[model samples]
Target: MQRYFIDSNVPESQKISIGIPHYHHIINVMRHVSGDQLIFVFNAGETYIVTIEEVEKETISCHLTERLEKTVELPIDVTLACGLPKGDKLDLIVQKTTELGIFSIQPFEAERSIVKWDEKKETKKRQRLQKIAQEAAEQSHRVHVPEILPLLTSKKLLLELAQYTHVFIADEEEAKINEQKVFKKLLNTMKINDKLLIITGPEGGLSRNEVTSYIEKGAISGSLGPRILRTETAPLYAMAAISYEFEL
Candidate 1:
């Protein structure tokens, strides 16, 4: 069944109108007809079954039929911060990480980050990442769409570390990789609404000063494993591992 993300304000027994783009897919591309059943999520853990009523030029209206089981969502909030990698790597990271159940993603400009996104480029970059995340959420059957935060500099991001309950910075030089030990600490220490921010650097990784600044901000340094992972891969790895540990 086709799944969609809708605003929570849409009430039961009322008309469910979808946007033109999705309407086109349902009407023209997928060739769905009246009375076709669909699944919708207002947010995480909220699902509803609806049947198509009318398909028009700009909108598709459906009748809310029944309430489905709440979609499975991650238990903990995990935000993966990547040190903006070069080329299309960031797209893959955002799409896959979203499917794996990350709460959100933030791309930061690290010391080794090569690509620069000024005001003009930042807008376009954000749109592209957001599109990728949305499509991924749909493909993975996620109930809620994860947010892709605006790009930030490492220093600027570090300044806000206090907001998160626990901040884990992925550094290869950190002590041995013990997913259990790190997660155990998180289990023993973390509570609901506690944001877990995981930072991963670019190809060349972060500079010593950058890591030091993160440390000063109280972000604990953690190692993923013995082998080094790419900048784009590291964040996904950290997010998936954390979701497995904390959510499952």
Candidate 2:
């Protein structure tokens, strides 16, 4: 069954009114008609099996058939703070990490970032990334959609680090020094529901000054493994490691 996230008060009425993109996907792409079955998730993050009852010219009406009882979210909240990379690398990071169960993704200006985000393009870029996250969440059966925040500056990111319970930065220098246990040790120390922020640099990696600044702000600089990973690869590796430790 096709699934869609709908913003509606489902408790008051079982009938759901869907229009535009969803209607187009259902009627045009999926060719769904009255009596066809599909799934819809409401604002409360509850999934429901619904049967198409009416298909009009502009809207599609669906009636709730059953409410699903399932939870596919991670035990702890994870926020991935990535240094803006060249090209569309951030797009891949958001999609894959969302599948791996990230709570949110924050892209920031790094000391070594080669590409810069023009202020005029920020809205379009953010919307595109958000759509990617949404689609990935649906395909991965995630109940909560990962939020894609606007790009932040280094100082702003450092200021926000105080809000998280734990913070780690994937530093190549740390890997070079064979600093292997900090990430795993911190994961072990974290309790359920703790919010973790994992920061990684762009292509050339974060500068010594940037790493030192984040460390001073209470961020633990750690190695993903013995070998250094690419800018886009490190964040995914961190998220997968987190899932391995907490979920499976």
Candidate 3:
């Protein structure tokens, strides 16, 4: 069954009226009929099996059939912050990380970032990523859709560090020196529901000054492993390791 993330909560009446974009996909793309069953996920992280009761020109009415169990979200909230990379790598990161159960994603300007966020198209780019995350969440059957935060500068990112319970950075220098336990140690210390923020650099990697600045913000630096992963690969590795540790 096709899945959709709804904008409102499932009311007691158990009737949901879905309109355009969703209605278009149901009627035109998926070619769904009035009796076809689908999944509707609400903003509150609730999933329901809904049956299409009526299909009109501009809207589709769905009656909730059954509520599904909710256990797909990560035990702890993990946000991945990436120093903006080139091309469509950020799109891959957002899509994959959402499937692996990230709480949110933040892209910031690092000292070595090659691509700069276009001031005029910033909102457009962010909306594109948000759509990617929503689709990924629905495809992966995730209860919660991960958010794609607006672009920020390193200084602005530092100011938001206080919101996370723990912070870590993936540094190539740390990987070269075999500094591995900091990330695992931090994980071991954290209980369920803790919010963690991890940062990865761009293709050129984070500058020494940027690393020092992150350290000053109380973020522990660690290596993903002995190998130096690419800018886009590092965040995915971190998220997978987190799932292995907490979900396995």
Candidate 4:
């Protein structure tokens, strides 16, 4: 069955109406009819099996058939903060990480980052990334879509670090040191419901001073392994490791 994320509350009468994009997707794209069944995820993270009852001019009416009880979210919330990379690398990161169970994404401006997003570009880019996240979430059967945060400067990102229970920065220098397993060690320490922020640098990677500043604020610098990962690859590696540790 096709899945959709809905922003409205479940009706008391168990009747639901879907409009616009979803309606178009059901009617034109998916070619769904009145009797077809679909999955609808509501704002509260509740998943329901709904059956289409009536196809209207601009909307499709669905009747709630069953409320699903399965949980598809990561036990602990894992947010990825990436130093903005050039081209469509960020797009790839958003789509893949959402499939691997990222709770949210934050793109920040790093000292070595070459790409810059002005105010206009930031808004447009965020919208596009958010759509990628949503589509990926639905495809992966995730209960909630990962949020795409507005671009932040390195300094602003530092201040936001306090909100998370744990923070880790992916450092290339750490990869060079033999027997460095700080990332795995940190993963072992994670408990259910904790909030973890994983930071990955861009093409040129984070400067030593930037890593030091984050370390001083209590973020642990860790290697994803012995290999140096590209700007886009590091976060996916981190998220996959997280899923292996907690979900698998």
TM-score of each: 0.68, 0.71, 0.71, 0.72
What's the lDDT for all of these models?
0.77, 0.86, 0.86, 0.87
lDDT of 1 by residue, 69-186 (tens): 5345664578888898899898999898888888888888998899888999999989999999999999989888889998888889987788887888888766475642564465
lDDT per residue (tens digit) for residues 136-202 in model 3: 9999999899988989998899898889999899988877554777788788677546899999999
Question: When superposed on Cα atoms, how far off is each prediction in RMSD?
Answer: 14.4, 14.9, 14.8, 14.4
Pairs with backbone N, CA or C atoms under 3 Å apart (clashes), candidate 2? none
lDDT of 3: 0.86
Give the range of the ten consecutive residues with the poorest summed lDDT in model 2. 67-76
**Per-residue error (Å), model 1, residue 224:** 0.5
Off by over 4 Å in 3: 1-69
Give the per-residue Cα lDDT of candidate 4 at 226: 77
Instruction: Give model 3's TM-score versus the native structure.
Output: 0.71
RMSD to the native, candidate 4?
Answer: 14.4
The candidate with the higher lDDT, 3 or 4, is 4
Q: Which stretches of candidate 2 lie over 4 Å from their true place?
A: 1-70, 176-178
**C-alpha displacement of 115 in model 3, angstroms?**
0.5
User: Clashing residue pairs, candidate 1?
Assistant: none
Is 1 or 3 the stronger prediction by TM-score? 3
Residue 12, model 4: lDDT of: 86
